[model samples]
Target: MADDQSLITILEDSREIRDLLTETLQHEGFDTLSFARATEFERNMRGLKPDVCIIDLGLPDRDGLSVVNTVASNSGAAVLIISGRSNTQDKIVGLELGADDYITKPFEIAEVVARVKALLRRKAPKAEATLSKIVRFNGWTADLEQHLLTSDDGKVERLSFAEGQVLRVFLSKPNRLITRDQILDDLSNGESDNFDRTIDVRISRLRAKLHDDPNNPKVIKTIYGAGYIFIAQVG
Candidate 1:
């Protein structure tokens, strides 16, 4: 059960699925708003500012992946993609586009509840002693509390929850080699083959935000067989 009354928005087109999710989440102590179309959700998104968004791929108004990308880039909310497409490519595409988690259709409601809780845990703020609200490195500033990244040129970029989590790991251990396993462990992301690929996609996304060229990356260098190392001086 959710500890607090976190707001959740469901964008599933199926009436049964939407109602089921809304009722289950509400019963679990979460405030939920269900929408059958993407346009309706988008119109109220800015106002609602849900903590988590449960989106389905097949929507009547717009592509769900596009919606996920917009939400991930614009809002601090975590995205969970629920679709009937169980293929690996779909999952990868969803994560690459900034979704935090992907759940295939025919999923257990309990699993949905658990995944929601996990996302909330990741979004929750940690103790001040462990992490500063703002961190700077290589002339870039990261507001961890706000999940905002500001460049030396005064440009600001919003980071998805997954990207922010990866950045936190690297910033916390600069000039040190951090294995993928360690990252997954710190993130508490499930141990699965898909999650391994998830780390790579997240790092790729973070590098883009940092303006780090993937061909010859300077900030985050990938060791052939080992892992990755953050070489920048963080403060």
Candidate 2:
């Protein structure tokens, strides 16, 4: 959200937990900031306003749930409950209290990273929060207002920033062949030097979100070094 990497605030008093989280997050290409306690976090998080907050439920001086509530209640960051609590009740309560994701103790770093990525995906404004309101393609549904996506009866999956951008472009120009060069120019705002694979990677990722088989694509058809065509019945 800030520049290219999303800003993440990790609030945990334990040095081990803090180190593990920072390692996992930095490996996933995130810009991270850490705090020792609620007081320290309150000042930094409010001022920085990261897109995501990975918070431990066992702070030294404050209730972790209260921190989650405060962050969610006051700031824009999506709060994730990362704690030693393993009971189902703890998880349920965390979710009820506005936690986007809750992980138990002894969790794998990869799992934490995955959950963070998913939360980040759900935070994308283009796919989840504004403009156009909705995009209807084939049997898939994208609701910007609610930040939800439903593929027929399947569970709702969140869209990342790049996926949202690629889909938004197609939704804006339905049934039309969009030139690769045009897409590159638009995605990079013509400021990219030479060429980059970012657009291609994003398109692939978008197709995955739509559940479109790259081998026998239904929604987006690649034009073989040219561009792409959105063949769905858009509305």
Candidate 3:
């Protein structure tokens, strides 16, 4: 209803839950559109792209995951899946398919609000945030918004969602040792499994993309028993 506010679209079949979410988001200064069916959401979303889309997996018309995949690919709106499915595999599938965050149902309203704000923080681009959009170091450029890295020689490398998240964390705390636990915690919303080895693999992949030598990497240095540090000047 509020045109000037950040638009948030909520898709839930339950009237009570839908109303509650719409009311909560409106109270939080977000303009919201509520849809009781996936088809309604799909059709309306074509004309009005919201800043965020809160999707419930139990839609009556269509599979919510399909909707999530579609929205993730077609819309710039951040997707947050709210489903009763708490299985790790389900969450992982949602994330891998491009959902930004996933939360189980019967969740605390406060937590929902918190996660919503967090997603908005990640999506909303400010001047200070723009500094993070393009990070250059060691002849490689990381574009957070575009999710691509460009080398000085004009070679472009596309980054996965998880990779982009990792790069963002590193850019935010440049020159500081970021522990594996910290990375897991920072990326907990996206990562379904909280395993240390997962972070190690991701870091290894990122280093490879940066062309850092595995034997003696300089850009992302492993701190023995502590963590990894982004040893580059991020401007």
Two-way lDDT contest, 1 vs 3, winner: 1
Of 1 and 3, the candidate ranking higher by TM-score:
1
Evaluate all candidate structures by whole-model CA lDDT and list the values in order: 0.87, 0.71, 0.79
Number of clashes in every candidate structure? 0, 0, 0
State the lDDT of candidate 1 residue by residue for 117-209, as single tens digits.
888887776555366879999999999867899989999988987788888989888898998778887776462344566788889989999
How well does each candidate superpose onto the true structure, as a TM-score?
0.92, 0.54, 0.62
Model 1 clashing residue pairs (backbone): none
Which pairs clash (backbone N, Cα, C closer than 3 Å) in model 3? none
RMSD of each: 1.9, 12.6, 5.3
Q: Model 2 Cα displacement at 139 (Å)?
A: 33
The candidate scoring highest on TM-score is 1
Choose the strongest candidate by lDDT.
1
Clashes of 1: 0
The 10-residue segment with the lowest total lDDT in model 1? 188-197
- Alpha carbon lDDT at 231, candidate 3: 85
lDDT of candidate 2 over 92-182, digit per residue (tens): 6665555656777888988887777766664554343334668777888886444356888887766543355556667767788999877
Taking the tens digit of each residue's C-alpha lDDT, what string does model 3 give over 61-176?
89899998888656667788899999988887777666777889889998887877877765545345446577887788888776788999999876655567778888888898
